[model samples]
Target: MNRATVSSSLPSSPSRRSFLGLGLGAGAALALAACGSSKGASGGTGTGSSVLKWGWALPTSWDPVFSSAGWDVHTLSLVYAGLTKLDPHGAAVPALASAWKYNADGTRVTFTLRPGLKFSDGAALDATAVKKSLDRGRTDPKSLVAPQLTSVKAVSAPDPTTVVIDLTHADYQLPNLLAGKTGMVVNPAAFTTNAAGLASKPAGSGPFTLTSYTQNAKAVLRRNPTYWDAAAIKLSGVEVYPLPDASTVVAALQSGQYNVAQIPGSQVEAAKAAGLEVQVIPSMVVATLDVNSSKAPFDNPKVVEALKYAIDREALLKTQAFGHGEVSYQPFPKGYAGYDPNSANLFPYDPDKAKELLAQAGHAGGLDVTLTTAVAQGEPEQIQAQLKKVGINAKIEVIPQAQFTQIIYIQHDRQVAVDQFAGRDSAVQAFQVLFGEEGLMNPGRTTPPELTAAVDKVTRTPLDSPDYPTVLQAATATAVRSTPNVFLYTVPRILARTKSVSALPEFTVVQRFEGVSVG
Candidate 1:
């Protein structure tokens, strides 16, 4: 099995106590025909609300590979399909690939693609296409999605329906990794049309085909009649509209301009009073504060520990999160297999201890730093207020979503950055993104040998092996001890829709239109 390793030293102070105080937390309509008129020219399904006007508080962009915006994934999921899909609960399940078998060494994986699958453009989905897609990701150095593929040794087509992938290291959680939005497959022919064709107009073998799109405005998708899983599709078309303001999203939902929209925790009661169906699920999304260890003050382990101790997660959670989330101590949230109960209780709220550690690091009075974040569902203003009490002066700067990737992921200059991680199908998914050598989430900027080794052990070990639990525990321990980043809370995803829709899945926050229906 191929394995990737990471290493880092433990900080001088013990891990802080777990944060517990934070407060947490699709459809259609039809037109009516004249009474007993037997339906004239407008007969078919009463037009059936052909377009699903979805209102989200984020901008729309066709470039899925370059944009980290969650809205991009929502659009891409409609236009493209991956080899494997993540279930509602964030577990990896087969999608385009009918079945898969891992070699005993775990370094190699062979997938039996479903035969007769073809792109909307009528091109067959064979091993060559898969290879081409993988190759593009590997070769594009500027691509954020490419680093996920450490190395693809070979991509061979044993037959029209089989694609064998040879990896440089054993990645037991490879399937989950592929399920990420970044690993979406694109049509090889379309990709070659222009060097950057896929970025603007993605082509894939999904239930819906992108018919039209307007950047930062709206996108339209039409049903793919040639879609292999057409029978499972319900809606004829979907229209996604970007509504970035929280108040605007609430107003739209109430006005019936949108069938579905994200409701902030503060508005849950008001939505319920208006007779809308409100559903809340544990979101895999987490918000955290990243300390820049590569720069001054924070370069010292003591300063990092002091900072962690000073911020009261409970107060932040209660005030900013509206009591809708759980305090997170590590990258892996509760309900995940790798979550460490012991580590969750390790850190306690202690301002005195935090001050002592700061003094030990040579900053007895306090320090001045700039905190950066993008406006989202959380309470950034309130979180900052709590940080000020600990002797640190934190200035908040909000940036646009398009510039977020460059500011946080690439530049990595902020003193403390508030960021989020999308839920993944497996623990390894969290491990790779937060601790992998080139992981985008490692804001502390430390890549120690010990941290790398621990993460490697967890990724390489088979999920069913006896030692799997041990490896997970060790990795979590390593993360807490090193304090690469502070894990805050798992925010709940609140979605509101009309009662006309049914059969919604339970696990993922993203809607799967297959089983959904209009009354």
Candidate 2:
């Protein structure tokens, strides 16, 4: 990249004082104060008047891997360019690499770099840079998603414009893999020295450059005059504020402090009532009740099935999501690939069946289990209430979001935990996330032999091959029928933005800043 000195300071959370220093200027300050009072203010008149003020819960992190954090992915989309971009429908589209072709055997893929492309720091974005970025990702210990490149034997830069990637196996989903957010191209020089250096100050060929970042408080993104697609750029700058409180975020959006902010399920109506443009996008996220199969009261298949039967997903969705979510029966959310609509539903809210199953498993009067959940999501409270109705003594243990990964995904100490994991667009990606040998969502603790076999067959076969669909179906069926997780609902990402903002494309996560304009 820029060959700048890498900072060793770990990314500190942004403080409120740092938020004010990010410089929203006089106009932005006024807008922030007046936004709540003036429901639908007219667009500003100045040529450079468009400075979009956005808000979210957390500050941007340094992780380049997509699977690491959702905040990182959202920030990378604004500052870094990926080899291939995923369209709204999760289809691949060209980004830094103009076009690419795969060999008939699907073992080799060649990409042609867009001529004259340069990083924000004026570093040339050539084949060598691409190779370096990919190589670093392949070797990075923090990169869980990049290791999936086990099939990628080597990456080469035969010419300045031509980059070739050789695969160990014929992977038909190579293009889809490239479309992942972690696949963002980096400046090799910047990335190689102190790989975590880019986390605080990222250098890429994106439309915006990181001007300043203060953890939890605010982040300032300045327009890149040297951006390859500068002509398409509309905003002069963007100020992102991290407001964890849903009420605060909604108030900021109404008060004009934020041009766009996440609106909680309960506050969607409030924003709409204030004349704010509310966008509800169908998210590929599942709010599921996971059973820790490694522990007692759940190790027995009948007990797990009993818990699944006891849950009333429709009621939970209505109460917890405020009737904004759709019921989900499998790991794959609706509209995702390999999601079979006709599969037999595992649990149909039959309390009597749940009782029978519990008794059959030698627990006639119900079982006592600790249910752990992240408090902010509202699923845990609702689930605990439901379980109580079925005579299960459930206690709710709330953990902070920052600690959830370690507590649930890594530790596996709890008997039951609720998963708010976002579903992957590709069936293979979804499968890997839920049932892969080292998947985070494998609450079953023990990966069943049948599930492992099915996943292996699908992973080895080409996605386009006729056997691919059958294998995927079998794997999904095995997962669903096994009842490792009780799939509940798909929650929509509700966002409130200014009416002047256009081209706010719907994303799997509600807050994508790309192509968004204020005025």
Candidate 3:
């Protein structure tokens, strides 16, 4: 979900920018596939108008709970209001719910909604609606946001203005979790029809309403003047283009056809040189080579251990990041609270050790292993060359990230893959999704139950407890030892907008357009 929410298993597409950047795939393929032409398009690119044209990749779905693509959240959030919103720093902030209070032990939590809030469809957004949305997400097995609320026993409304959530375990981070897509309020009217039926017809209480939405096409949103928090939004309308290629997004920004653009870091200087305003937004993404433990070669712990010393993370980060990132030696980034400062030293760059381990594991000359990545993302040739040095023949296979998701996550047929494990506002969110049980959208290879249980124990540990950091760091190392994922590097998040555009505030992940205004 890398909003980071959602898994790679969603109905496919792409997000997390820089896809079609320097040395990457061409953008015309994505641009041509989209509804070609028309700055005249209704998203308000009209002459001398008070409208904001936001350009980025399309969404998986409009259903707030069902939506997983990260880029979609930026625009969709403008149309749907969560109980609370996660700030750029990942802190929970007031939104639809003005204030909240928790019981002494944290088992029971109550939220107080801002007065007189109404959905885009004219339905009152009361405590009952909050309960409906939460219960639906908690019960839906496929809901990406459900795992965070696994401890919730019931969602009840004690009164019209107050909603109470009863948790079986004491969860201090429930407020932060609720501030995500799962806790986003949705109208029961649209949901009553069918789950998939709410794809394009999402009913919400935000600054905008969905006038139109087409898969792989542009989404048109009109201003909701009646919105409770609509004072700062001066735009008459907003049009979001789901352009896949990074080049296309840059082109849109440069051409003055798009007011706001989510540009890749590779093109920051280029976009800036083109006179586009670049917002250097810091983001988190852990590039890793996951060795499917369920399969051969990787099944041997020594062979998996050998990989830790094989690749040069610093060199890889330099090549991939263009000097914009640092090596990610642990499962979680250093910015994460529980990150072990010593994990980077766990496996230093030692090709000799890597070779010896491989030979000891009975792969003397190294066995042939396949590495899969998106067409533009995985410099498969570079990796293929690097693996050759260690006598490990790594064959490269490149495909679209969307197809990559379908194969690795949905089909679960991948043997070894070079994947990007996105950073989450909550550190446990990424761990639970990537390494937990298969049911929680563990897109990576299945780990042993012991690993899962140990990781789950960390999630249950109170964040404030003294043992919290120890448990958190231990679980990460334990999982890494399982050889499911080889820590790679972290990349920066970037965004670009026209100079004329106003109020484009930055967030770690684009959660919402709180005070965005367009000239």
Provide the RMSD of all predictions against the true structure, rounded to 1 decimal: 8.5, 9.4, 7.5
lDDT of 3: 0.66
lDDT of 1 by residue, 1-519 (tens): 122210111111101001101110111222212122211211233333344566763223344454445435556777777777666555555677766778877778888777788887678888778777767766766664666676467777778777788989887777666765655777888768764645546688777766655554566666665565677766667667765366666667767677776676776777777777887777667778767787677788988887777767787777766777888777666766567788885666788887788888888888887778777435667666666777777778897755665677668777777777664545665665676555666665567788788878877886556677678888888877775577777777677776665534555535567756556
Would you estimate the TM-scores of all the predictions?
A: 0.85, 0.85, 0.83
Stretches of model 2 off by over 4 angstroms after superposition? 1-47, 376-378, 460-474, 509-515
TM-score computed on alpha carbons, candidate 3? 0.83
Full candidate order by lDDT, most accurate first: 2, 3, 1
Tens-digit per-residue lDDT, 329-375, candidate 3:
76565655556676767878788998999999999977998887775
- Clash pairs, candidate 3, are 1-4, 1-5, 1-6, 2-5
Candidate-wise lDDT, in order: 0.65, 0.66, 0.66
Judged by lDDT, which candidate is best?
2
Runs of candidate 3 with Cα error greater than 4 angstroms are: 1-49, 68-71, 141-144, 376-378, 439-458, 461-478, 481-483
Stretches of model 1 off by over 4 angstroms after superposition: 1-50, 57-64, 375-378, 423-426
Higher-lDDT candidate among 1 and 2?
A: 2
Worst 10 residues of 1 by lDDT: 16-25
